[model samples]
Target: MKMLPSKNLLMTLLTAWIALFTSSYFFYWQITFSSQFTHVFVGCLMLLLIGFVYVKNDFVEFEMFNLKEK
Candidate 1:
């Protein structure tokens, strides 16, 4: 009956992650290969983004399977 504590934060994080990867994928597929400097920059940026997201939100995910039928 209650909502998750960080649903919005997770949504925002997922949206940002999708957007960043989409742009990078577009560039990689449509344009030339990215340079090492670009790779380093994006990697650092992604790490910082993930770190910030991790620190700012309380989120966890898991999977469940029910072998017994109801």
Candidate 2:
């Protein structure tokens, strides 16, 4: 029923990009070590990056549901 905030949308896109790259790198490392630790590390890194961006940008709206829980 409503539109997403421009900055929030941009942040979401950037976060997705970050996650995509991180996942790719994780898979690459998985081939080398044949272990899941690196994947977990990459996941943690993605979470940290996303959390930092969200906190810094204050993207408090849910674009899909058009809800503001803040």
Candidate 3:
């Protein structure tokens, strides 16, 4: 039987996908929002925050599993 993916791996993959999508979306509208530096910066900051949370949650889950197995 095949095993399911770990939380960390899934979160990493999702974060990558989200980053790519956000970058492409911003790039696509670059011409229209060329002067919106604050918006772009805020968007990037939010994405980073989201990624950090996911990674942290994954780490916590991993730790919990390890503790349970011991």
Per-prediction TM-score: 0.35, 0.36, 0.51
Ranking by TM-score: 3, 2, 1
TM accuracy, model 2: 0.36
The ten-residue window of minimal lDDT in model 3 covers 28-37
Per-residue alpha-carbon lDDT of candidate 1 for residues 1-70, written as tens digits (9 for 90 to 100): 9777698899999999999999988776644357667888899999999998876554332112232322
Write candidate 3's Cα lDDT for 1-70 as tens digits: 9999999999999999999999988887645565687779899999999999999999999999999999
Identify the candidate with maximal TM-score.
Answer: 3
* After superposition, candidate 1 runs with Cα above 4 Å error: 1-34, 58-70
> Cα deviation of 68 in candidate 2 (Å)?
24
| CA displacement after TM-score superposition, residue 7 of candidate 3 (Å) | 31
lDDT of 1 at 30: 44
Model 3 score (lDDT): 0.92
The full ranking of all candidates by lDDT, starting with the best, is 3, 2, 1
lDDT of each: 0.74, 0.77, 0.92
For model 2, the stretches where C-alpha displacement exceeds 4 angstroms are: 1-5, 31-70
RMSD of each: 12.8, 11.8, 9.2
